[model samples]
Target: MGDDLVDLSEMFARFSEHWSPKLVARLNDYEVKLVKVEGDFVWHTHDDTDELFLVVAGQLTIQLRDRDVVLGPGQLFVVPRGVEHCPRADAEVKALLIEPTGVVNTGDAGGERTAIVVPI
Candidate 1:
């Protein structure tokens, strides 16, 4: 599929669930995932790796112990490794997540919101 291009808009239209991340592609040891998120996500931290969140549409707020980082479309934020953070969205938000392949969505705070990777 080297000649094929993955379209975010088309892929996002096929899924209707929230907080479920769908893997779009892989780059060596890392994976690029798309997630539809609404409401507040559980507080968690990835002890071994940092997570990059890029807002594809709508807005996202990453709550930290000291402050909240708000992001809109085209904005990006990287939560440093071992930093506790909770992601929340006031409305439906589409985002791209970049992290190591085996990293869990909820990190150490695993729950129903912990997404299992679904390759597209």
Candidate 2:
């Protein structure tokens, strides 16, 4: 990690791909990631680690097995470990994801949407 301050806006502006997470910082065993999301993501679960979603812009809807958790800018939600969920957005949504260093974005349902996170 760099000693310099990270500008989220600048990091976001450097990328344009949806579903791909860009690493911004590291917190002990966790990674702070930024991702652009639109449309629907795959239904998946992380059995060992919980996933955190913090909306930076636009709106996000986390479609759970039983209910949908909707989040807008400045809001955040933590999807507990082993809970199935799919993230959806009506428009473009910029979000900050906090999870373990090697946690896969697609969890157990990996496919095309799986992101290889690289620092911005």
Candidate 3:
């Protein structure tokens, strides 16, 4: 399989549900994930790893204690470990998530909204 030819649009077309992350591909020790999101999510932090979020479609608003980040297509951000963050999309948003292999969506702030990490 060609990584360059691996289309995000095709992978994204597979899921229509919200907050459920789909395993996409991987780079080194990190696994890339895709999730369709809408509505508000609980604030949480990954005490173990930095998490990367790349907006693939629609819009994503990330809220922090101090400020908010608005992401559009091609925009990306990294949440450093232990920094509180909540992600919300007024409408359905598609995103590419990145972090170490086995990293949980909610991290140590676990509750619901967490998907079992798939082995690549």
- Pick the TM-score winner: 2
Q: What is the lDDT, from 0 to 100, of the residue 51 in candidate 2? A: 93
TM-score of candidate 3 on Cα atoms, chains taken together: 0.90
lDDT of 1 by residue, 13-83 (tens): 88988998888888999999899999999999999999999999999999999999999999999999999
Q: What are the models' TM-scores?
A: 0.95, 0.97, 0.90
Q: For model 2, what is the error of residue 93's alpha carbon versus the real structure, in angstroms, after optimal superposition?
A: 0.1
RMSD of each: 1.3, 0.8, 2.1
Please state the error at residue 64 of candidate 3 in Å: 0.7
Residue 88, model 2: Cα distance from true site in angstroms: 0.3
Tens digit per residue, CA lDDT, model 3, 9-71? 987787687888777787899888888899998898888888899999999999988999999
Lowest lDDT sum, 10 consecutive residues, model 1, at 1-10
Candidate 1 vs candidate 2, lDDT winner: 2
User: What lDDT, from 0 to 1, does candidate 3 have?
Assistant: 0.84
Model 3 CA lDDT for position 115: 73
lDDT of 2 by residue, 1-120 (tens): 387888899999999999999999999999999999999999999999999999999999999999999999999999999999999999999999999999999999999888899988
Highest lDDT: which candidate? 2
Rank ordering of all candidates by TM-score, starting from the highest: 2, 1, 3
Show model 1 residue runs off by greater than 4 Å.
1-3
All candidates in order of lDDT, best leading: 2, 1, 3
